[model samples]
Target: MSRIGKKAVPVPAGVTAEIAGQAVNVKGPKGALSFVVHDLVAVDQSAEGIAVKPRDETKLARSLWGMSRTMIANLVTGVSKGFERKLEINGVGYKAALNGKVLTLSLGYSHDVLFPVPEGIVIQVLGAKSDQIIVSGIDKQQVGQVAAEIREWRGPEPYKGKGVKYAEEKIFRKEGKKK
Candidate 1:
C-alpha cells in the first residue's frame, strides 16, 4: 500500500473540490484547475476529504497511486494559495525588465533576449538593479517552466559563478588558472 495515497487530502476552507468520473475539479479564490486522473487509480471525495485507491493490486496501479493523489493535492493548493518561483541574475550589466507582457533580458549577449509572457503567468522585476525576477502563477508547472526558461538565457559558470540562477540555488565554484 502507498503511504501517501492512504492519507486523505483535506480541502481547505473557501476551496471546493468536485470529482467527476476520472477528473477532479478544484476551485478556490486564486483560480480553478482540473486534473484527469490515470485509469489505474480511482479518486473519490468524501466528508473526510479526497481519497485515492487502486482498482487492482498491480505494479502500475500501485506505482501511480501515490502520484495521482499528490497531483490532486497540488491542484487544490494551486487553486487556493498559488505558486511562485524566484530567479537571480549575476555578473555586471546583467539585468531584466518587464515591458507590458514581455520580459526583456540583458545577459551580456550581443543582442537582448525578448521573452513573451504567456497567459496565466506573471513576472516581476525586483531590486534597484533589476537583477532579481519573481515568477508567479496558479499553475505550478507553468511558473517553474517560465523560471527555467529565464535561467537558460545565461546559466551560472563554475569559474566566475556569474549568470542567472534560482534564489535558493547554489553554484559550485572552480579554481582559476595559476598563471
Candidate 2:
C-alpha cells in the first residue's frame, strides 16, 4: 500500500553497503553511517539494492515500512553526496564568522553570540558581508539540525524581515502601524 516502500533503494557505484541483522551500514566517499531497522519492518540487500517490507499487515508495520526504507535511502545518499543547509542573515551590522571551531554571530545584540560547531559538521560563512552561512555534513539530520540552531538565534521578523533565515525561505511581511 505504501508506494515508496514498494520501491527498492538503489546503491550507487563506489558505495559499499552491508546488512547485519537489523542494522544497515553504509560507507561511501563522503563518510560512513548506520541505522537499525524496526522489528516490524524487514530489510534486505540484493542486486537491485536494498529492499524493505512489512513483517505483518498490521497498521504499525505498514506505517514503519515506508519510513524504514526512506531512512536507509537517506543514509546511502548522505554518505555518498552528503547534505547542506544555507542561512542568510539580514539587518544592519548583522553578520556571521567562523573562528576555528566556533561561529561568531553579530545580530545587532549588545554582545556577539558564539556557537560552537559540533564534530562531523562544517559551518562556513560566505557572501560579501559574511551574511551567508553554509552548514554541511554527511548526516542529513545533523546538517539540518545545525542550520536550524543557527537560524533560531535571530529569526526573521514579519515586519522588516531582518534576522537569520534559510536562503530559500520567504518571510511574510506585515504592514506597519498607521496612526
lDDT of each: 0.94, 0.95
Cα deviation of 94, candidate 1, in Å: 0.2
* Residue-wise C-alpha lDDT for candidate 1, range 1-179, written one tens digit per residue: 89999999999999999999999999999999999999989998999899999989999999999999999999988988999999999999999999999999999999999999999998999999999999999999899999999999899999998999999999999999996
Q: Pick the candidate with the highest TM-score.
A: 2
Global CA lDDT of candidate 1, please?
Answer: 0.94
- For residue 131, model 2's alpha carbon misses the true position, in angstroms, by 0.3
Instruction: Write candidate 2's Cα lDDT for 9-98 as tens digits.
Output: 999998999999999999999889999999999999999999999999999999999999999999999999999999999999999999
